[model samples]
Target: MALPTNHSLLLPALLKGSKTSINPSFTISPKSPLTISETFSRLKKQRKVGFIPYITAGDPDLCTTEKALRLLSSCGADLIEVGLPYPDPILDGPVIQASTIRALTNGVNFQAIISMLGKVVPELSCPIILFSYYNQIMKINQESFMSALNYGGIQGLIVPDLPFEDIGSLKKRANKKNIDLVLLAAPTTSNYRLKAIVDASDGFLYLVSTTGVTGARSNLNSQVQFRLEELKKETSKPIAVGFGISKPEHVKQLSIWGANGVIVGSAIVKLLGESKSSEEGLRLVETFTKSLTSALP
Candidate 1:
């Protein structure tokens, strides 16, 4: 299939422009929260392509995470994916796994991350999306976790390890809390499973660029464009590609491939970890984020 020349056709609802806040009033209530569609709809009106950057909460420390969140929002991130540190992160690559290990060693856990979010989310302009594994969600009572997310002002959730075939209960629970359960689709996904994942995804479909774990790569797979086109036919919902995405060129190419958004994880996480200090780390993230956003079509 030939790609659309007009980028607006990629995801018109996201490119059009409206109010982008998940909840404009800043009310802390998951029961009556803003939908992901509303936030994307607002960005659509502004004709801005979404830029999602991931970070491991408390990797360096909670204070650094706080500063990073503020800097990321001010720089260019449309939505921030905060990775909740877990003991076994099978889906994460070396960069992310190392960051999580650092976070965990520092005594960072889901509850601590939520506490940090509660303080930082109110200050951020973009929505906070908690990324975690299924085991952690199950470890805590589901309802309680939802309540904490609500109280923290989070608008989205992404469980990469949750199989699409078995996400029914988790999806339902997140829906009840008015939180978007963002699902992932991989290059290796079957037609049947791809359709299910696309339909179930709330905020945007996270299309993994390759079959392997998440990490930065110099070149995205050659089949990425074809795979994105195939996923597009499955659903009109916003599609954001992740895994192996790093440089501005990757963002540009993916945008041309009809991606509504781009998710950069390892690259950002590595930058944060490599920084000499909190201020330097925030600056590194800020500069890199700006470059990625500027590359969006």
Candidate 2:
């Protein structure tokens, strides 16, 4: 099935530019939470797995990053993950690490990143999730970070480095704002830890397909299927598998394994790096985004 047109879901204020400000005193609807399972179900009915592509914010430059995001959303993304540039991104592979370095070099700090998003969010069709390390969040006052994210129209957050034991304060803040806080469950995670992480997670459970950093791999681990099965039995929330998922075949396999979503990052960023200009980069990403998403089922 073809993806739904944005006309049905685009915010009215976005169309007229009349709603320039997000009402600070406004309250979120209790039913407005964007859950992983809900997103997966919506995609499943369309015979597709959610395509969540990640790109470092301000990579190359903020303009390119924004263009890439708009392009991805226009082409076929169900959701977009904007990686906050961090100095020490341990979980990221060389490609992402280099992208982060470039972004930081271009003066992409937390405030700048959020400010950019505030300008672009009103125009976006797909939901935007901020992917960052805990330290980046810690550097700013917690309340301030949450306020900025809310103001920027962020739907969710993913902090790969945050441990289950250390999520209380963050969870409370996220819950208060009605923003989903997605937690990652790695292959190395024990069952006890998995339950804890899932219990704390609000939007969806991000299952890292491997034990290490994020990068493209020749093949996915066969064990990822079993892991998905186990996780399915534990929670009704959608399970999105990332880490080393770089190819169309991986996406197909993930769907067959009952995964609700597939996240492709390094491969997409690598393509962007190869393009000569931001416009060319966006075109390339759009083409690939449609191709990979079309192969999901």
Candidate 3:
């Protein structure tokens, strides 16, 4: 499919220029957060394992999403992945798929997320990584999308289903904007593929601990320890393990095996999914995030 160059068509609500528009209070002024590379390097020197939590934007509501983001940052999150609500999510399991559906049903989109982030990013201490699929990225186009990232203080982007062979152009564009195109490395990836991923992925290589789609599990894939060790041998860049990470014990185990960070998603998304009110959602996020962070070295 051809990407639409006209970004105005990307989000009518955002470009409408009303009080409900994206720039109601925050202008499209560039306010970039720290780069993902710098954040990982800083953590490496500090000898701290980064904790990145994933949440769906506008899940309970967009307003609640903002509060939850701030709460996560304050709760010791090194980075936050805000899943841009898409009609189709390539890698999401039921928990995240349900959360994404909730947000989309409430009118969350690429532009809405950018609008929400514009006001929320300035207050956040850590970098924000936007998790989006390929078509959604194309819908916003490249340059305008990068501009929106700056406007929203987002520092990283993850296209979960993007082909490794096709990442050249997008990765080049992201590099120009200092936005890390974080790539995933699964347990089944061969060393040749892993080597390519090491060279291509910025910030850190996202090691999917399981072979299947993302969801919380009682225990992690036992092969993750060996995979972490193998990745450490091949690349100097940080390695952050994600997928099936739900428990503090999982976080501790990853850290002990030399992981630079851990990304927890379905578990946190589930917490906010059950919330009856914004307050309850934020409270659940805070308590659970603190538990995960405390387990990290």
> lDDT winner among the candidates?
3
Cα deviation at 88, candidate 2, in Å, is: 0.6
Model 2 vs. true fold: TM: 0.87
**10 residues in a row with least lDDT, candidate 3:** 17-26
Clashing pairs in 1: 14-44, 15-44, 16-44, 16-45, 17-44, 17-45, 17-46, 18-42
Error of 3 at 139 (Å): 1.9
| Model 2 stretches astray by more than 4 angstroms | 1-38
lDDT of 3: 0.82
CA lDDT scores, all candidates in order: 0.78, 0.78, 0.82
Worst 10 residues of 2 by lDDT: 2-11
- For residues 111-176, could you state the per-residue lDDT of candidate 2 as single tens digits? 567656766766666778899898777766455566567766788889888878888899888777
The list of candidate 3 runs beyond 4 A from truth reads 1-33
Using TM-score as the yardstick, the better of models 2 and 3 is 3
Model 1 poorest 10 in a row by lDDT: 7-16
Sorting all predicted structures by lDDT, with the top scorer first, yields: 3, 1, 2
- For residue 226, model 1's alpha carbon misses the true position, in angstroms, by 0.7
Across 68-167, the per-residue lDDT of candidate 3 in tens digits comes to 8889988888899999888878699999999988988887666667767877787888889999888776765665566567556688899999989999
TM-score leader: 3
Off by over 4 Å in 1: 1-35
Error of 2 at 84 (Å): 0.5
